[model samples]
Target: MDAMAAIKQTFFQECEEQLAELEIGLLAIQDGDVNPETVNAVFRAVHSIKGGAGAFSLDDLVHFAHVFETAMDHLRAGRLAPSHEVLKTMLRAMDVLADFVRAARDGGCVDAERSQTLAKELRALDPDGSGAGSEMDDEEIAFEPVLMDQSMFDDELEAAAAPPVRLFTIRFRPKATLYAKANETALLLREIGLLGEMAIACDASALPLLSELDPEGGYLSWTIELLTTQDEAAIREVFEFVEWDCDLDIESDAASAAPDDIDLAALIQKMQATVEAELSALSPPPTRVDPLAEASRKDADASADPGVIDLAKARQKKSEQAVGEHLGPKPDQGAAGGASQPTIRVDLDRVDRLINLVGELVINQAMLAQRVMEAGLARASGVATGLDELEQLTREIQDSVMAIRAQPVKSVFQRMPRLVREVAAMTGKLVRLVTEGENTEVDKTVIERLADPLTHMIRNAIDHGLESPEARAAAGKPEEGLVHLSALHRSGRIVIEVSDDGAGINRARVKEIAASKGLIAADASLSDEEIDNLIFLPGFSTAPSISDISGRGVGMDVVRRSIQALGGRISITSRPGRGSTFTMSLPLTLAVLDGMVVTVAGQTLVVPLTAIVETLQPKIADVHGFGGGARVIAIREHFTPLIDVGRELDYRGENADPLACVALLVESEGGVRSALLVDAILGQRQVVIKSLEANYRHVPGIAAATILGDGRVALILDVDAVVASSRADSAAFEQSLATAG
Candidate 1:
């Protein structure tokens, strides 16, 4: 990659980060709780991106950035107050800027229509329409300060007419490890001798005695006075490698001798010109070239003159290539120049592919272990030891690969604040979102899929769940309603819970909605937990108004379906006027699951272990009908619903004596436990989850299919769906029986 390309890559990465910060800041502002520091942070992110773009001569980026930064500066300095209208416009501007940066990086021209619209919006923020003269732009926009003026140059030229012998005083301190690798300070002195006439002085005051010295350690320091035609930078370059590890100070003779004869300004300008020429020559060519060809050429030349290869240039090239491959072709130079933003864009497909490969590796390793066991390696003397080592190594590799795909849930959670703020603003409520476990790691796929569901839950919590600020204060709660979003890994599943401290779900209101929607019978008996879950039924919202924020009656059910599709379940718990909590438990990865294999009518089925509560043998007497076709199993005093696996799956065979059947007790929505009677337990194993949607339509009670260690496919059961189907069937069976009687 060339210098321009490398700089462009960094610009996009920084822009992305700035956009994220801008999003968070806007959300906070919308919530009516703007923090000055957060505003400043967002301003700085934009400023940094603009600066980087300027360095690469991306004018388009610089132009819009200048305007956006001006508006942000006004807000930061308290000249302009944050309001709903302001935030909305700023968000739209942020989106436009993101597109501009992307277009620039891809070598495509910016959309003139969109750019003008965004520029108009920014200009509107300044009533005068000038949109200029921000102090920050004047002081902070320039990379560095200009050192000398033209008058200083003219005076120096007149003084330089009389040639003068310039003397210099130099002080140098070498780091402790400077002479440890068979190279001595003598080599450095020899190199310096070639540059000028020098007087060397050694400082040995800090060197310890022979007994106290470490054989491999260096202990020496030196200083020098040189009379040379060489410039100051040349003298400084002699200690460049050890600059950070040592201290060096150089004093020009003008300070100690006749100032008129020395003419320091003339010498400095000459040195600057020479440095600029050298830098321009060393810089990469202005024209673009094929990166692959460049890489090949560099690799071939690496052997001929190893010292000549610039590591910085090589690394820069690699980073640019990586970015291009990940984010597509570079944006047009003009489009890139206008926005000072930094962002690192990565392709989602690459992340998905990486996860898929890791999943396959895990399955193959499991198969290998199974083969070793079948070969009787565990019973053999030395074979068992080797097999154990192999298993350990395989497991280590699996863990390392999985770790690469795990990303903090923060990227998803950070969007919640904005959501809460928007919902609260629309509903005329005050809500503060408190988030925990933002750093918890989950599969990138899980994180992406989780964003929508989490947004819905948060919106619901703010719009319908939380009471108005006045109502909250009257009820003894804080004036600012609190909505809590938390996520954590429990029993191999990531559990995300969204809870609020305001008005909870009204059971009567939910029941009324269910009845009006014809979802439940009029006099149906149900538990409190069951009533709370009715909100997840399709089109079962109790909101009285239809607004752009949330209440069109089409979110909760979708959230549930999305969670279930990812091999997860969603549940709710609420207390009257005490708030509600919606908890969603999702699989660690969609590609694989830790499952327990079981046999039903000679067919193997995989049940995710996370849903299994216990296993037991229930006698015929414990299984009794509960009026409908459904049966209940009495375990101690509590009666749990029972779903016959054979009947549910339409399996036909000689019925196993009911008394001898083994029950796999599983928990479903709202703590509804069910005993699934299978033929036999086939033990537990990790299996790769293969999507049914890839080849076949989704089966009602099956989440996915996986290949077992024995190489046979087993369908993974969706316990939540099974329970749901059983209840629906029971209700239908009861209605049919009543009609017949």
Candidate 2:
């Protein structure tokens, strides 16, 4: 690949990894469970990506990296603790960084407007105040020299005979008209320094007397002796820029000559020809030289007055203007400057490949352990003990690799505050966003998928669940409504709750909307939970008029779909005139899930353990049809919606075999329900989620497919979609019964 292509690829890869690490680290920090090492890791991940981008001379990456690295530096040094506001701002900055990287990868310039807005948000987090200068003392200053060490060179020489060093004598002479051009000799020299070491001697013998001099004319020349481990082609790079401007000659130094085995004669001849071509380009025609010389002399004489003007300050101002012009506006320029933080850009595909490899290794390790147990090799010889040790080591390695993929949910959480502000402003609701447990660690894939659903839920909480400012005051609550967003580990799953303390979902309005939308009949008697879930129905909205913020009847349905796509579920709990909480339970990682492996009519199926509330064998008397094939089992006084999986999947041969069925109670749009009629309950295991879209296509009731331990592909049951489909069927059947009556 070309330099730019390689750079773009590397940038995106590094960005993905950095984002993952940022999510996990921020989540841990927000949960108050992160350590100094974790904080440092998070900071370093961002810093590394920035450094890599800088290496490619990408300006947009450098600009944002500088700002983001500064904030992370502060956090790393404990100057800034994980606060709700700071974390939110950091998250927003990360989003901007992601955007910039994406734009750069696509060969587009950074989005100036979005970048400026995000930078302002990041700067506001560290406004001039209490903790400004405290973190400086703790910042670590470290460096990695690019030069090869003498000891390493010696060791290599001892292993394989040392390669011959080449020395070249180079003469650089600039053309008389060269000074008029914008190119600088110093910059050229700096570029050369990146290649090798050299000694220089300036020749000013051609300089004329002060009276006869042209100040702007180039008179100086340099003879340099370069001692490099690189060949003659490398030496030519030093003088690459000045090739057209100067007279150049290159030859091998006799003093540094090695054996005849390593010849330098041909290399020296090529270097001389390369330099000559470059120098010839810089030489101008002799006809126009006199006028330029005269102009230079006159200009030099006119500026001879020592006290004529404050030229230094004028030059400084001009330089500042030039910098401003090149860099555009400096929105956060006043905050601080001169922070040395190294960053690197990595290719996200590579990181993803690495993660996949690690996941495979984990699976292989499990397989090996299973084989060892089945073989009954505990009493075997030394090889058995070594295998045990290897297994332990493998486990540790797998854990470390998995840790590299762990990212905080902070970046995903960060966009919420701005969203909340916007939605609140639009709805005229005074909503204060209270974020907790932002540091919850999740895989990168999960974090990316979670952003949209979280955004919709937060918007729903502010717009629909939270009351208006005036309404809040009248209800004897604080004038400003509180929307609490929290994430925590609950039963091995990440539970994210978007709760609002305002007038909760009005059940009466929900029922009315549901009735009008034909989602339910006017005479249908539903529990409070079922009534609350009516909000998730497609085309169901209680709002009388649609607004720009929401209530076009599309938010919750999308949220539900998004959550389900991630192999997660969304649930709601509410009290009339109080507030509502939308709880989303998601797996820690999307790559693999802890699933209950069960067999239904000889086909193995995986049900996400998170969705399995309680599995039981329901008595035949408990299962009864209300009307028109709508089955409901009386669980205490409340009736639970029941569906027979065997009948639903069209499985044959056991429709009425004692009516013994296992009920996997799952939550959905119609609230919690015991899914009746499954053949048997199987053991639970962690199964890798494979995309059905790759081989086949999406099946309505099947969320995804996973490979069972026995190598059979088992479909992961989509409890929510199945429940929704079953409920729709029940509603249709009931309507038919009404028509028949």
Candidate 3:
């Protein structure tokens, strides 16, 4: 990529992070958290985007972000209240701002009408008319501080005084690191210039001889005398990004605030002398002197070569580290105490490559261990012990690599509040979205795919699950319905739920729709659970009419398929007049799995360990034949459906005898338990998952394929699909029997 393209890519990547923060802060404000820091963060997000857009000369994006930033500035300054109407407008504007960013990055066009509309609403939020007009011609609008006209004051004296314009003498010296971050002294000075009338003087006394000078070294500083109504805080905000990379000191002089008549050169010299005196008094003793400083002094005294400066600085840094270790851990070093750790951004492709290599290492380790066992190495033998150690190391390496790809689900969850608001507005429902466990981590790939299914589910919740305001009021519930979204890790998988406090699935209505659509027999006997499952059937719809949000018999069934496509399952539970919850359980990573190896009809298969509850040998007395060749296993007096894996996958023509097979008790995503009958148990191991659909083709009752220790490909069982297929066949058979009778 060219330099401009690479920088633009980085800008957009940073925009994603900023956009996430913007949504989170806006949502917090909507939730009644009007903390100053929260408002500041929100303001910074929009301001940063506007500034970057201006740099790229994205006129439309810059214009929209300017209007958006202006309104946020009002919110930050308390000129606009975060009332419901105002927050609603701000949220809409936020969505538009996000669209503007995406449009800029993807070379797409935004809806100008919508942008203009949102811009007008945001401008109207300003209590005064200052923010109500277009000032695109004012190039400084992005950096201009929020200020009120002095003429607005009632008292003449107050109007004349206007706010005391304090004089600040700021000394700014930027190191090479500052420029390395793409920050420029010229821009920083320009921002300070925007604050007020200013006189700036450059100090170059520290500059080394041309022959001795390092090109990247900091050799000059600027001292500025500014007279402005803005305080020290406003001046500091301009330098926030480069604060750690520069030495900055801002001194206020309210008594002598004149900048026009001051002698800048003389004043800076005097200030420098005073600062040097103070530093000398506080300096460490000679024995503890910084090596870099000593080296510089020696170079001056003996006229030594300046080439040793870098080596001395390295020595100084090393000495500081040694002393810090000798002093032991600092009280502030505790991670639990909230010390910020440094982080670096790496290309995601690199992390994925690392994860792939770790997965191969895991497979190779398994193969090596298998070879060792085949060679008849005893468990106590050194070779066997070494192999066991290697296995443990492989697992640790795999886990560490996986952690790199694991990201919090917050990225997906953060987009839902916006979805809920848009859906509610479209459906004319007063709905509030509540979220929890947003920090639950899952693989990046899974997190990316989660957004669509989650968006659909939340939309379904608002449009279909929730009732209109009047309906809610008539039902004695809050006029505004509530939709809750939550995510958490359960049984080595991420489970996300979208639930609503509205009149839940009307089972009668659901059944009627199913029958009318011919999805199920009109007279078929089904439990409430089965009726609920009917919604997952293709072409099933309970809505009376098709709408933009839902209906057309497309959403729920597609939701199921999408979830299943990720090796996941979705289930729903509802109580009439109460609410409904759609729960989805998905694997944390698609790359690897912990599975139990089992043989069925001489074919090996891997069952996900997360699904297995226990393994038991089925007794003859505990097995009973059910209708139409189905069987049930009695466990603790409860009869659970028993599925023959061999028969279910058509690996064998006949159902296996339950008593002779090992019954693996497992729980489905819906919390239903069943016993899967297989020929024999072959122990459990972690297997690297290979996508079956991508490599081969989608196989029924099989989730994916994996390479075993013996170098044979074993199919990984889709436990839920197997159980589901069995129930489906049994239901059909029973209906046939009813017809025969």
TM-score of each: 0.64, 0.51, 0.81
Model 1 Cα lDDT, one tens digit per residue, 1-741: 698676567668767777777776776677776767788777776776677677777888888887888888888888777877887778767767777788777878778787767777776787555664442333445477687767858878887764444567777766544433223555566667666556554443453332233333334455565666667887776664455445678887664344355555555454445434433333223575545544544553444222222333533443354345433333332222222333344666776676677777777766776787788765565867775676577667666766767888988987776577667878899777788998889987889899889888888888888888889888998888999999898878888999998788788878888988899987776678779888888878787877786657799999988998787888888888788899998887776667888888778998889889899998877888787556788988789887877777777533345566678899775567888878788788777889886768888888999876667778998888888887878867876776678
lDDT of each: 0.72, 0.69, 0.82
What is the C-alpha lDDT profile of model 3 across 1-741, one tens digit per residue? 599998898899989889999988988998899799999889888888887888799989888888888888888998888998988898889899999999999878889888888988887787887655554443455575787886655588665565666778899998867655556777898899899877655554574332233434555677777778788899998997777679999999747444455565665466556544433343324565555444544454354222212223333433353344333333454322222344788998899889888888888888998899899989999999898899888888888889888999988888887788888788888989899998999999999898888887888788778888898888899999999999988889999988998889889888988898888879888889999989889888777788787678887888888898899999889999999999999999999999999999999999999999999999999999898999998999999999999999998898887778899999997688999999999999999999999998899999999999889999999999999999999988987897899
What is every candidate's alpha-carbon RMSD to the true fold?
13.9, 23.0, 8.5
Per-residue lDDT tens digits for candidate 2, residues 1-741, read 598676567567767767777766775676676588888777777776776777678777877777777778777777777897787677667767877777767767767887766765555456445334443433576888697658858877785665565676777777743444445665665555465555554444464433333334566666665656667777676665446556888887555444453444554455455444433344223564545434433554355332212334433432343344333333443211232233454556887787677667656655665566677876476757776677577656655665666788877877676677668768877777778898889777888898888888888888778877787788899988888999887766788888988788888878987987899888776778889888888887776788886768888999987887777788889877778889998767766666787778888888878777777677777777677556777666667877767656666533534256677777554345656557787786666677786689878788889765445578988867677677767867866777778
Clashes in predicted model 1: 32
Model 1 segments beyond 4 Å from truth?
1-10, 18-44, 56-354, 362-378, 381-392, 470-477, 517-530, 541-545, 619-639, 652-658, 669-672, 727-741
**Deviation (Å) of 718 in candidate 3:** 1.4
Candidate 3 — worst ten consecutive residues by lDDT sum? 304-313
Ranking by TM-score: 3, 1, 2
Give the residue spans of candidate 2 off by over 4 A.
1-346, 354-403, 513-527, 541-548, 609-643, 652-655, 658-677, 681-686, 709-711, 719-741
User: Which candidate would rank higher by lDDT, 1 or 3?
Assistant: 3
TM-score of 1: 0.64
